[model samples]
Target chain A: MKTTRRTTILLALVLLALPLAAFAASPSDAGTRWLHVRVVDRSDDGESVRVNLPLDLIASILPEIDIEPHIKDGRVTLAPEQGVQLGDLRAVWAQLRQAADGEYVRVEAGDGNVVVRKAGTLLEIDVQDGPEGAEKVRVRAPLAVLDALFSAPEGEIDLAAAITALAEAGIEDLVQVEDGESSVRIWIDDRPEAP
Target chain B: MPRPRVTLAAVLVATLLLTAGGVVVLAAAEVWRAGTFVLSVRDEGPNGARVAVVVPGIVATLAAVAIPFMLPDEAAARIRPAAPAMRALASELAGLPDAVYVAVEAPGERVLIASRGGVLVIEVDDGPDHVRLAIPLHAARRVLRSVAFAAQRTR
Candidate 1:
């Protein structure tokens, strides 16, 4: 009887272990790691722009900018988490139009840097990373232009005030723009951590 | 199968058709019932343009009716290509413990590997081959919950 009981226990253990052994032989044992992404855009004027960044960096910035990711059919799609009403955009546009004083403004990013230019006015802003962990922002424009853009009547531009205005206009709190002499520059050390 | 003569005839006919404003529609009627419908115009000067519409609908319909006869032929067989994502999932599953069960759905095929206990269903996108497997946030949350529950049960 003891021998039979021992044999039964051994048989039960073997049955339980057989599935475990089969699972151990699966191919997806090691998890995935790095991801690479590349994007290229060409304009009719023969100007081309290319951007290459890691997927992890994009995921880190999504939450900060209020973007959501949807995973379906082995792909992840990104979209704005909150929809912006037309009224909000109209309000911001009205504010910007008043500040522009009938000038055209254009913003572009390429080669790890952002550039903002205001036509008919000496307004140019360049944003990039600094030597340290701090972000570097350089602005070269007229004091009057900066003051008008920031809605500062005293001819003085405050970064905090400008950012507050933008926030009120429905912009996310991703970065704060600072005002400098003859320009505005904002620095923030909010780089996302690498996985 | 008729080489030189057929090729010369095809070229001459194509040139003649182009000059006469006649369009020659080449259609794989086996795939679509409508097939290639050609609408040609022959300008006769004072007589205006004579419009002639040639539709291969009848031929396509006949071919569709004869699909049963064509099925036995090896040439008519549909070939299903294996999806790369399914292959990757299979490779990954091969190294896991025997308790794991995996169900991988590819473009036109479904592969199931059930072993012991845990079940994992992977749905592959019909998108480009470069796209890797993406686990939905809800699914991941469910897995986390299960793991937490198991850990708590053990405790």
Candidate 2:
């Protein structure tokens, strides 16, 4: 009788835990994945524009792309359909390649791809798999106001110049720029207020 | 006290198996994809509980694909053309702004929040049978309820 009772109790406990275990095992087990993609650029004449590029980029660049919203491992993951061409990503990478220095900035370009990372620079650019194996590059800002420094042909991409242009456009909003080993961050004056 | 009699071990094992089965089923069926949410709903018949995963597509294709799996051979014969109905419904829901806190419904027939309009038409395939909701956005949800309802709803 005691053994039967114990077995019953065990079974009940297992039943109660079934859903909880599944929930815990789910990627959300850690937390929900919230992705925010911010794109800031100047239009030829230099009117500072910053907009959320997550959905828009998906629609415009990869029409057939799929976006899975989930939390995987410990970090939030936005697994976009194979390849999505993010304009800001391309622009940042182009700038990084031009600013590559022998020691600080390292450039590895092969297999129709390019990667640039500068030790002291305010940004770290990651170029990886995208839709249909296309290059999906991500430029991370390590500092609150980190800027990418690059030297492009005559009128191409210039990091310092872009910074100057941003400042001139109304960066009393920009506070500080932090450079990381992997990414760069830019802090704006209205940051604490503006996200 | 009136207490329930159930075993914890049995419960856990059963739950694990059920969850694993669900995961496997979903993966195998390729029901997992972008812009789609999986949901479990009960049937409204004497048959009691039933699981039906809903998807968006043209009505005819939906009827064709769902009839064989959701209903028996006899009932599928009664199903008729649903493409015209789905197209009308899809066209109405296509271009609404992404504003939260709105309720769109048709009295007792249906009450739902406006989710984004995708390429395919919304469908409800009750196992072995499919039924297309002919009501469009304008007719389903009254303007006042659609625009003023402050409750949150996910499409």
Candidate 3:
């Protein structure tokens, strides 16, 4: 009887710790990702702005916003005259998702250079000299976010799904723009606060 | 012997009354502590004035909780569809970690919105005029959830 009692106590302890162990394992799965944006303008009074927002909260609230005539129900319907076909985007994304990680494109014009590539789980874009003073521009996004972006129906882009994916997928430095006197950075990560 | 017994009985009665009084005071204090919310307003406009208001959060809480019974059926039905999402949003926001969500500083004014210490704070400062509003995050979540519950409880 004592042995049986000990076994029962052990079982109870394990059951009590199960949820806590799960919670500690995957934080992003719990909707704990934060999106951070920081901008510094040295040209002025050395002013800076920082914003950190919770993604799950955004995902929960996105459905209520109505951007009439274009966006509804967390999806965007591209204008016909814009000539952007959903099928084409889907096909291209499928190819990219399957392709091996490598430098895919490099364009050099008279004034600038543009490079697009897939690296590990991220799609990276590096553009230089695109804007007059923007000597370097970099953007990175997870493949999962892109996949979710195109998960909508035949004629729409699923923004809410993409955001939800972004919140779940491992996120890191996303965009950076640097110039002589100003800098802007936007990224998403599991951190609770802006850095 | 009868007089001695009477004295003992009187002592027991006094002890019981004191204990009862102590218990009542503690209960009232707990209630007050649970409902206290502080409001401070300072405006240095043309003339300077400072005022402080102490309000019991229970008033707002009670009003929110009473919505289900007080609201008309048509209105309740109209809000029921959206209640779940609002409740979910409120719940998620309450779980979010403390962070500064907005910080903007311009020439004449500054605005800051942040969640800190289990409270959501919004502050705006423009020269001599300043305003700051803070609400406990958990209290807000409770109120909002109650509102959603009310909406969903339509007949």
Candidate 4:
């Protein structure tokens, strides 16, 4: 009787603690995150494609794949062909990070207009080009992700850290592009698939 | 066939009526339960092509059960990684309030994507063609969940 009672009590405690432990681990918006990329091509042959990848898998595999001199050691090194200097990028990023949350750059030209600003937790960028500025592109990412990109030394971008930030932030619609043909959206969430 | 039994014929008639009544009741119940599913589409077009689709919530939920069997091994493996994200998207959309997620108006074309009262709607009007789709967010989530489930079983 004692053994049976003891076993029953232990089982009950375990059952009770399971939910509490789970809640504590992921109280609200915290858990394994999945990155989602959706493209809807609405042209002559309309097609919708969805790609979902877990941040953990991406973080693990990114270092394994090498793209010559440009990407190595889970970090991205700029090539001479790219023309943009790492020092300039780092300087701009540092300035943007410290600056107050507001529109920093706004250019309205005859061809197009570009807007780049820091809003809340996101670095928002919008670019309009083409005829009458019809083609539009928007990119939004958490500050943490940007910080991770510059985490490495010698002006190399640390992709692993950036992925970790993307996983933790649970961001949605990190990048969106709209044109006459189709619209593309990429986001990160806790879900593995898209509907 | 042995005696041309009247009882058998009577039973057949009674069974048909009972089944028919049961189907009607179930359909009504489904319509009522389809809160996240059914929504009116206020779309304007020159052609005025209208279509009514009564997709029960259960149908979307049931797709989860069918995923494993319907998907091939290779496809299921590919989908396994994305199942969780599908569930997350579904959950977020289901809870989101009325808002326009995307709206683009171009020459001779207009596209609107919005969520209203837990229902996700997509509308596109191009030239004389107009298409609108409204789905309860929960149903979409359920369908996505099934995809996740199928992905797991494949592994």
Best by TM-score: 3
lDDT of 3 by residue, B108-142 (tens): 67888887765677888887777777766656677
User: Which residue pairs come into collision in candidate 3?
Assistant: none
Instruction: Give the worst 10-residue stretch by lDDT in candidate 3 chain A.
Output: A22-31
How do the residues B35-100 of candidate 2 rate in per-residue lDDT, one tens digit apiece? 333344555666666565544323233343333344543332332222222333333333323222
lDDT of 3 at A145: 89
Model 1: per-residue Cα lDDT over B42-62, one tens digit each: 443465545555544344344
Off by over 4 Å in 3: A1-31, A45-47, A63-73, A81-88, A130-134, B1-36, B69-84, B149-155
Quality of model 1 by C-alpha lDDT: 0.34
RMSD after Cα superposition, model 4? 15.2
The TM-score each candidate achieves on chain A is 0.20, 0.24, 0.72, 0.76
Cα error of candidate 4 at position A102, Å? 1.5
Provide backbone clash counts, one per model. 23, 49, 0, 15
Q: Per-residue lDDT for A51 in model 3?
A: 85
Error of 1 at B152 (Å): 52
lDDT of 4 by residue, B58-119 (tens): 77767756866898888887776555555555445444445555565556677777766557
lDDT tens readout by residue for model 3, A1-195: 566556555555565455445434522335467788899888756677888887877787776545666776778888657799778888988998999999999998977989999999899999888466368888998898898889888778888899898887776788999876888999887776632
Tens digits of lDDT, candidate 2, A18-133: 66675555211111111222232223432221221122212222212212232211112322343443345446656654674433444444543445456453445555543343
